[model samples]
Target: MVFFGDSMLETLGRVVVFLLVVLVVLLASLLSLFFVMLRTKRILFPNFVLFIVSLLYEILCRLLSFFRVDPTLIDRVSVEMRNALNYTEFAATDPRERILLLPQCIRSIDCPARLDSLEGICCVECRGCAIGELSARSREIGIRMYISPGGTFTERILTRSKPKAVVGVSCYPNLYEGLLKAKLMGVPAQGVPLSAAGCVKTTVDCEEVMNKCKIRS
Candidate 1:
């Protein structure tokens, strides 16, 4: 019994350490991105400072949960994400506007058995991530959400739909590209970047989008 207790404690300790390391890495990445933005003159220092502070708060909450000091913050993050989702606007009320959900990495057709399914095409309804939920929500909202695995497919969807506005899910680079394309084409666009959770799929709250659109109750 004592040995088992010790083993469990050790495992817990390791998990805490891992979480701390991840938090540090996330902070570093944010700082690096902010610096890059500064160099490129994309964002002002005030906005950068605000972003850094927000990120630090989120990281602190995550770290607290890692040590079992406060599990509530994990729920807070979920709530915040949901609220953020509400702040995004979709293109139309016609139920045909195209909203794209792009995954960074996808499973390849010729890869090994395990990797074969990793490609976005084989989105087996495993519900391993938030993609399923986001898809369901998109359907509920009468918006078309495509699971695009690459840039080519994403562009193809855009070319086909010609949506008035877009809510895209991608990394920084893809988000920037999509924003540029939208600007050039006079399409309003909102992007939600994926975090480090390895859950390539995303979580979007419909209420948030509705709120952004100022839709009536």
Candidate 2:
């Protein structure tokens, strides 16, 4: 009985040590990649970095917070990584088969867009905000635009529109999750971060977004 108990304890200890070593390795790898990317404004081993980010996302963010670093830093890195990795495929996709998704918070406070079951928000081009002008340009280029009311509506719009590629504009955290979700759905995507992020009256870089929208092979 004693021998059996000792063997079990030893096995458990070994397993625990192995897991701790793996955790440290993953964290170290992510930190290295993060700093390198930040300094160069470029991604290195994007696929490997992306896998580590996805695996350690929550723990990495928590660790950053504990160390007084911005938690959103990881999200920003992940979004940029995805954008660089997906750029080729995304640019190759036809504009007619692409969708430009905007968050509703970027709209004017008194904007009068209404929600639809299939298309999230119906933009009337009331010239209430940049969406009107963007809408006109997107129409001219034969691309579809959807103003998502919230995060959940993104999947719905993608499913109904069946876009080959997507250019999504949102805050870093949302862009991170949105890009990951689109990747899982086998859709290439580019993310444009908001210049000013908030729940209400957020602002995006309209020129940057339009530039992304017009990327071609």
Candidate 3:
């Protein structure tokens, strides 16, 4: 059975080589991520780094799920990664150049808000939910805001508004999607994920959004 023994050894060698290559690639990516964090104004590279890390974390999430652990660790890592960026760079930007994107799911499912075509959500401050309250505050701060249900609609808003920075609120996956798209457009972006995620009645932290806006009295 020497032939069988030699074949097994050969298979083990290939597996070892494959694993070494994967380890080397992951180490390089980690080093690149570290350097990007050290001086993030190396703007373009940070976006690419974020994309790569996102893919890595997505794989980790799948592995975690296979073990029946919390799969949301992927989203958590992604949120932290996005938050680690320098938000203050856009602090002094004009309000017109900034947009706050609110998912329509943030509204009460039975709420009477309507789409205004150009404007995102037509709100009457019914006090049914945080939508009216946030709209009022965003107006006071002079930052444009939209409450969009997903579709070509949000993309249309992006095209028309052409924001240089965005404060978006949605579930983690949707938030991540927006970040990647904003990166492609060379827009600085951040987000607050919903406290709960679903097709209906998701909620966000209004206080956190205000903090992001750095709103004035």
Candidate 4:
């Protein structure tokens, strides 16, 4: 009985060591991928490569969570990873194939945009908020624009519009989810994180979206 107990302890120690080794390896790979992305300011890889990189990033995040790290830190890392995905190609996508998705939180507090059954925000260009400005700019570029409240609404809009590519603007949490959704759908998607902070009455960098839209123009 004493021998058996000693052997079990040894086995458990070996397993722990192996797991630690793996954790270190994964962290190193994730950091390496991150540095490469930072240096290039873009992923510059095909979808296959991007998928692998994103998987590594997500794995690292999960592993870090085991350490009880702050959730916001993980979110920030996710946002940075999402941003480095080299949307250069997506820039040139056909306007018909692209959709610029904005968040409802970006609307003016008193704005009166109505929603339709098809998940469309009927913005009469009221100029009540930046959405109007963005909507008008997107129209000029001949790209479709809509306001999605969250992942579910964005999913519905994607299904209804069936856009080939998407550019979403939102806070880090929602933006991360939307980007993941886009990847799952095999749609080329990019996101812009809201510069301002908070859940409501937030603002986005409209110029960045316009620059992306102009990539195809």
Per-residue C-alpha lDDT of model 4 across residues 85-204, encoded as one tens digit per residue:
636556557866789888888778787888776766678889887788998899887889888755478888888789878888887767777788887787778778787858788887
The TM-score measured for candidate 2 stands at: 0.95
TM-score of each prediction: 0.44, 0.95, 0.75, 0.75
Index of the highest-TM-score prediction: 2
Tens digit per residue, CA lDDT, model 3, 47-122: 5656666657666556568778676644544655665563655565666678888988878877998778788688
- List candidate 1 segments past 4 Å from native: 1-96, 104-124, 197-217
Ranked by TM-score from best down, the candidates are 2, 4, 3, 1
Higher TM-score: candidate 2 or 3?
2
**Candidate 3: where is the Cα deviation over 4 Å?**
1-49, 215-217
Q: What clash count does candidate 3 reach?
A: 0
Inter-residue clash pairs, candidate 1: 86-208, 86-209, 106-119, 107-118, 107-119
After TM-score superposition, the amount by which residue 147's alpha carbon in candidate 4 deviates from its true location, in angstroms, is 0.4
- In order, candidate lDDTs are 0.51, 0.91, 0.73, 0.73
Measured on C-alpha atoms, candidate 3 has an lDDT of 0.73
* Candidate 4 weakest ten by summed lDDT: 44-53
Give per-residue lDDT, candidate 3, residue 178: 77
RMSD of 2: 1.7
Summing lDDT over every window of 10 consecutive residues in candidate 1, give the lowest-scoring window: 109-118
Pairs with steric clashes in candidate 3: none
Q: Report the C-alpha lDDT of model 2 over 1-217, residue by residue, as the tens digit.
A: 3566878999999999999999999898889889888998877898988898898889999999999999999999889889999999998998888999999988898999888877889999998887898899999989899999885799988887899999999999999999999999999999999999999888887889889999998
